[model samples]
Target: MDKDNDHGKNDGEQRLESGEGDTMRAEGRFIEPQEPRAEPGQSEEQAGTGDHATPERLDHPIIEEPHEKPEKRTTTELLYGVIANPVETLRYVAKHKLVAAGILIYVAVAWIGAFASIPGSLNSFEQIPEISGLPMFSPRSIIVFTIVGTPFFSLLWLVVYAGILHLIASLLKGKGEFPGLVSAVGFASFPMIISTPFSLLDYVMGIGISLYGLISLPFTIWTIVLTIIGVRENYNFSTARAVWTFFIPLIALFLLAILLVIGIIALFVGALSR
Candidate 1:
């Protein structure tokens, strides 16, 4: 009996050592090898929950930003820049309080220059005495009126110019301000100051009004050009609109004047016949 029991134990040991335990499956499939066992009271699946964590993300796209504009200039710089680079100066003047300063400068220059050049314009006037009947326009009275009323004239001009330009610009879908338009018109008048000296030269040196007019014509043209730019810039409109804004009013005034003269003549004829 002892010999038979020893033989059965030996056969069992041989079967285990021959890899029969490895072929055993839990649910009709071979068991996969696993990591070391978890701690006390912890299952392998529960331990894996602690091991899994949120990952870091870094795949977002970059975004861009806009740059800033340049700083503004001073009133003096804008004054000098008017005839030099009118568009830039008008832009500067429109956004600042420089319109007041510009209008003041124009009025002062015009007053003093007119007073200074009386001798020349008077000489020119005396030579053309063919129309002496118009005594209200004597050289002395005209000088007095200009000296006393230059500020008023300048202010009136500013209002009219700014008003017309703002209206036209608004009609054309522009987004300009009235104050800025005033500054633009005021600064556009900067070129007028240039002609003052030449007028004085003609008066003092007696170079003749023709020469003075000839020399000052370019400055007048410059003033007109600057004005056109000012209107264009302040209105933020096309060059064509700016040109029309300037000349239309003047043309209308001329037509009105001709109509008035014709009406007055017709009235006088009717009165004489009656």
Candidate 2:
């Protein structure tokens, strides 16, 4: 009975040891599952959203954008630009004011001198003695000659005025042909023509000289104003400059008048000697 009991106890101890060893071997074989890893150039969000596809490049040549051009002014627009703006007119005059003034002064002096000398010339012809060596022309003949010559002088004056105005316009950087100056002068002459009837009536009356003088004042002022406008239109100068430029010609004319008077005296002396 004792031997059987010892054998039972030994068998129980061996079973216990085997159970512990199996538990340890099972624990060693178990490994934590490896976590899933992401590859390079890929994000967890991209992968989740399924948007990791590469963008494609185009194979054909790229077209460049074309550049835009600037706008240009038209002819009528340029014409208005030349005439309408006073600032532009002044600028034109500032550049060529001296020449313009000189021409104007010459014209003024010539007109004044012509008017002043007319009566003296007529009287001189009337007083010409019908002596031996004198010309056979009578006072009536002389008067007729003078009257005939007036148109020629008038035409000459017109030509000179137009030519000078054109030259001034050219100096001021204006564009156009000579006709521009002619047209301008022609327009300016209108006031002078209108005043003529008044002048004739004044002559018929005893107060003709004073009345004509008053009328001439307005005519002169108008002429000067028109001259400035014409110059501004032709030369593209500002109004102020064109107005200032008038002095140039005025001074020249004053000087020319003095010279003309001296020349007349010298001619008179020479004639007396002859």
Candidate 3:
């Protein structure tokens, strides 16, 4: 009996080693093998192999490209940009505070207009030799005067106009610098250049000056519109606010002139009564 018990125990051990015991445990049915599951925050490779991960088996790191900045506009671009696309160009001008470009534009327009009038000026003065012969009235003197005075007055107007706008803008809760406003205002005068060709033609061909004046009116309005746009861009103001900021100074000056005239008339009447 002991021999039979030992033989049975040995047979059971052999069956387990030969995989027969596993099949028997399935109860004559096939069981599918389940894949391993990855833990939370753990990659499949890491979960599958733990510390046995290899560099060649892992994914490559991602690299990002650097962003490029926009290029600056050229002089020719700026010259036509204000007329063609005032909003974007003026915004760029205000941001850069391009004082030199602004001054160049102002000086160029002023000089062109001044040069165009040279012939008309000379012709008008020719009838009066006494006036034309004066050193100041001579052609050379006129050229020199325009050369010197155009830049000076251009710069002066930029400063004065910008100062007035800056003050008004500040009063209206605007946040922009004097230099920026100056640049914007100088560029705003770009539309005035439109009249140069007509002025020259009128002077050279004996065309009526009234025709030039008529053509200039629209350009003047264009300049005023550009000025408003510049003010709006620089000050971060609404259209209504920018318009008000520009016209307020002019309105104040007009009212002041009217009061001065009224006071003068009142004094004149009192003196006459006496």
Candidate 4:
């Protein structure tokens, strides 16, 4: 027994000299295993699963931000925006639902302006001996015609004009829908409203049709310019494509108008000859 005790003590002394603990663990030297570090580019959730497991804890969900509303503009501002900066305004109108109000105001202004011009137009026409001889050219008839027919013709013009322009734009690979183009194109007519005051002016000033035409010409060109820009903005067309899309339909409409005038004159001549 004394020999065994000496052998065991010698073994313990050897372990201590070798910097290793004996069979029993050392007090206050217990090593705790740490969680394996998350690998590079590995998410905490992903790292926690599989080879990188850890105690599961509840995670708060991520929240999203709320959207802001668009700022409002007045009617006068809307009109001015269309006139001064049609590209931006028409694009906005193209995406908005209140476009109908703009179009409605435009229609009202145009019709009222037309009504205002009729007395002058009739006065000018009455001076023409041949035109005055017709029973249909009287002021009463003119008033009735405008009262009854203006809205229909105006809206018809709007729809047909929008449809033709949209077709041209579509052929050029433009990416706009027709309804939006209608609203945008209708606002392009807003320039005509600017000229209406001048139409009233020519009447108030008693200038003839020649001066009225002269006064309307500049505004007419401005309207066309805005229209081209509107087409470009709304349809995302290049400058050349937009101009071509605009002018092609315009040229066709002009030719059609000329043909219509010629056809009417020919019929009138035939009737007079008979």
Candidate 5:
């Protein structure tokens, strides 16, 4: 009767141990066991069944798959892509820092526009009945000034505009660099290229500047929209944040102007009272 109790107690202990081992394995606290091995002078079944048996655990290695690279876009494709897939295209421009290409596109458009305006300017003079001779600011001189000034002013404006947007975006928790944002905003002006043909038509057909202005109005608005998109993508910001970043500088300037006017009016009132 004592022998039976002793055997029963051993069996209960073994069951408890097995249950713990199984729980550990299920919870991933222990690695899975390898093939069971027999002890010296012990049968495989006896070794596997006994408490002294502890099979080795095998550690599996983790393998990571490589990521695919983004496709490279040519300058032409990038310009077209702005219209087709603005988000991805602007992101690529910002990531790649295509500053030169963007600046070139803007400057080229400005130069073309300056030249196109020459025809209209000359035509306007011809329409006036009062003046037989060229005025002090002659058409030729104005043309020369326009052509020479377009490149420098356009390039400077691009840099300054990009800088303002970058600063505003940074204030809004943007993570983009100035050069990247320059490229982004530069590319954002891609939609303005659509007006080139209209300018060309105005130049060749002697259409009034009014026609060009009418045609460019919608495209100008579109360029502003693209600028907002570029800011959003470059800075990884939400649409509202990007819009705020774009407009904040403009709003500040406007408010400053108002304050200056008020100050001037107050000073004039003080002078009048004196």
Candidate 6:
């Protein structure tokens, strides 16, 4: 009986020990897990599971720097800039040369038509004698007059003429592609069509006495303003510089006219002496 009691006590102690071991194993399983360790040299930021994992703070500040806003340009300032840059104005003209050429062709055709209509009108003035002391009324006379006068008027027209071309090109290319001098020349000449009315009126009223000069004045001023603007744009010049450039072509034109007059006078004298 004593042996049996001792064996039963030993069996109870073994069962108690076994139960304690099982409880410890179950407790270990119930506890939350720790995050796995990252590899060496790997950043915690890259792991994407840090204490600061909220979306608002998740984006790394180092990747994005703030940008500055661009300054705005006023219309007056833009106009002034265009005029100061003549080379750019000309370049603008050259780019759209086809359009410019088309306008010139149209003007030429109109002038031709005007000439064609002149003969019937002139018939009302007088009849021709067999051989009058004065030169016969020929269409060539009108043609000669046009050839001589057109260039003078055209030169004056160049002020705005070059400006208009430059303006169009610059505007079309976007403010970024600032035009050159060729563009100014090409584009600006479009408005010279305005001068056609002056010629027609001159023909109808007999040249020197008509309101043609008064009518052309506004166009002349407009062209000058445009040329100045074209120069400013191409060159990126100041307003003062643009204003100054407006006079440069005029001065050049004046000097050229003087030279031409002197050459003509010299040639006339030489011929008279011969």
Most accurate candidate by lDDT:
3
- C-alpha RMSD for every candidate: 14.0, 22.0, 9.6, 8.7, 10.9, 14.0
Candidate scoring better on TM-score of 1 and 5: 5
What's the lDDT of the predicted structure labeled candidate 6? 0.52
Candidate 1 at 225: error in angstroms?
0.8
Q: In angstroms, how far off is 171's CA in candidate 6?
A: 26
- lDDT string for model 4 (167-187, tens) is 889989999888777777777
TM-score to native of every candidate shown: 0.64, 0.42, 0.72, 0.70, 0.68, 0.40
lDDT of 2 by residue, 197-270 (tens): 55444334434466667967886776667667766655556776556555556677899999999999999999
**TM-score between model 1 and native:** 0.64
Task: Please give the ranking of all candidate structures by TM-score, highest first, separated by commas.
Answer: 3, 4, 5, 1, 2, 6
Estimate every model's Cα lDDT from 0 to 1: 0.73, 0.54, 0.85, 0.78, 0.82, 0.52
Model 3: per-residue Cα lDDT over 1-274, one tens digit each: 9999999879877977899778866886434456667888877777777754567666764455778877989878986899788999999999899988888888788888888888877887776989988999998898888888878887787788888899999999998887788888888898898788888766688777788789899999999999999999998999999999999999999999999999999999999999
- Model 1, span 1-274: residue lDDT tens: 9999999778656755886545544344444558666777775544655552223221343455667776767767877788577787787777664667767766776676667677775676677767534675687687777777777886776787678767767777777788777777777777777677777777567687789889989988888888788777776778998888788777978999999999999999999999
Write candidate 5's Cα lDDT for 82-181 as tens digits: 8999888998998899989989988887787777667666667667756526563577677778878889999999988888888889888998888888
Model 3's TM-score against the true structure? 0.72
The total number of steric clashes, by the backbone 3 Å criterion, in model 3 comes to: 0
lDDT of 4: 0.78
Which residue segments of model 1 deviate by more than 4 Å? 1-69, 121-147
Q: Candidate 6: deviation at residue 172, Å?
A: 26
